[model samples]
Target: MEAHALYELLEKYRQGKCSPEELEQLERWYASLGKDRPDSLLEEGSEAAQVLTSRKLQELHASLGRERRVVPFRKRVLRWAAVVSGLILLAGGARYYFKPASRQGELVKEYRIPAAHSRHITLPDGSLVILHAGSRLEYPLAFNNNIRDVTLVGEAYFDIRPDTAKPFVIHSGSLRTTVLGTAFNIRAYEGSPEITVSVTRGKVKVETEQEGKLLAVLTPDQQVVYNNMGATAVRQPVTADSAIQWVRKDMVFENLSFAAVAQSISNRYHVNVRFEDEGLATCPIRASFNGTEPLETVLSVVCGIRNASYTIEDENDILITGKGCLP
Candidate 1:
């Protein structure tokens, strides 16, 4: 379909003059032509048609040392104009749907993680969420007239602002964690072996709808993990000062096994650390280090303390093996 036909069809559709079947046929034709057109043709210039003509014609002209261009100048110009105008309309439509309003205050919004990195997002209600790697967080483009609600995937830590009348509820998988005015962490990695909820400050009530049970009311320095088998609550002492060290370019490892440490480091730096030594996986260590330093330096220091050896094959791959301190 050409640009004139497309514009006519669109106008008819807006006026409700096109039949359903005609509209469908027009849409199909538009999709087929749009997919085949080169993006460069969507720009204006003398070179636009010069780049898209038939390759066979180019070879023939080369052999004869003579050019036989078929496209008339007026037709070429109109086609180019249509291409540019179509691109502008498409771009404007996309921006209208995706970007937030400049001055619109407090609208429900949704955010998703397309890559590995923590996303620092401020919600419409002034609450903040630090979305961890491989996570999804969705809320309305604007919040409700009263309370604030958001859904989560993977893991996220929330630092919520106080609102007396409205409470915040985060839905993770089937579990719902609710809080009035506090900060907490929720880990619900998809198909992960466990779902964890840790609270550094304030209080949160975690509820499981499967059994209609209140699993735990977590306070500061408390955590709960729910798996298919069951849920367990642990009351452990943790420094609130460094609860979210990952966001600060630092990771706190407290008596973590080698395997667990490798996973944490991988998520923090977006790199992979593997232990080739089978025995090294179980070696335990308690450490915290700044992420600003080269990962090799941190790895060297940790391996030195644990009596292990490692080699970095490249930027993303590090092999930690050989001797490891026995637990």
Candidate 2:
């Protein structure tokens, strides 16, 4: 069927004006098109083609009438997009609705964790997430038929449910992780030097978002680190517990420099720890806290061990001064 004919039929369907014969004809055309050349529905960068594609979507929603529940308009649009996207893909159609603009109608729910705090979330798919301090996660109000996808900033630990038909996907910065069911942790704080994805169980496929290149296929006790500055990834083996200590509110420092320590402390305590002597920033410290100690106590232990002195300038800032650590 011609694009114009399809559009007219869809418009009629949307208005509930299609006769039984016309409806059957439209459905047959849809099935036939799916089998033949579904990609012809939309031409790239063509305004007229986009309009027809959008109308076809509306017609599909109207025909199904399965999504008329009490939900936000944007969410309804997203549900339709997801369903259509899956159907088209299965029919060998061009991937159209993946674009942000095409799926803009899908409502997004965002959760943010403030400094010195964390939050636990249960997704619509029964996936569990623990968002670390100063982090944010954005996901659809409900997953689409094709995929369970979410975007994260800062850090989070995920325990995704098993759904082989619809994979769970996470997007952090330029990295994307896809898994059927897995336990993993992702640290992608904006200012952090790298984005890290560590898998604790099951398997995950990590890829670069821009090029859609496979970076790694990680299994249990494995991790992939993507350097934000260089856009490079390195896969390595690690102990799962070490990678996910933050979920337990446990802080572990293993021969880490003061600067790195400060960053971790700042994230956990929501305070700025500054080094008065820049040299002290490189001092190494090895410590572990169960996250039960008060911030002041932790700081005191750290300072006393390093022969450093610290002062709380205000509620949100801490200054540290000491002689440089002996090499």
Please provide, for model 2 over 1-327, each residue's C-alpha lDDT reduced to its tens digit, 9 standing for 90 to 100. 554455456545533467988878765654453332424545566442544465565566555455544544324433343344343442232322233552454545666664476655778998888788778888876888698888898999899989989999899999999999988999998888899999999999999887899999999999999998888889999998799887656367889888888877766655668899989989898888755355687899888878998997534568999988777
Worst 10 residues of 1 by lDDT: 94-103
TM-score of each: 0.44, 0.48
Task: Find the candidate with the highest lDDT and give its number.
Answer: 2
- Candidate 1 segments whose C-alpha is farther than 4 A from its true place: 1-108, 231-243, 250-327
Candidate 2 stretches with Cα past 4 Å from truth are 1-102, 250-327
Give each model's whole-structure lDDT: 0.62, 0.72
The predictions' CA RMSDs to the true structure, in order, are 18.4, 18.8
Clashes of each: 8, 0
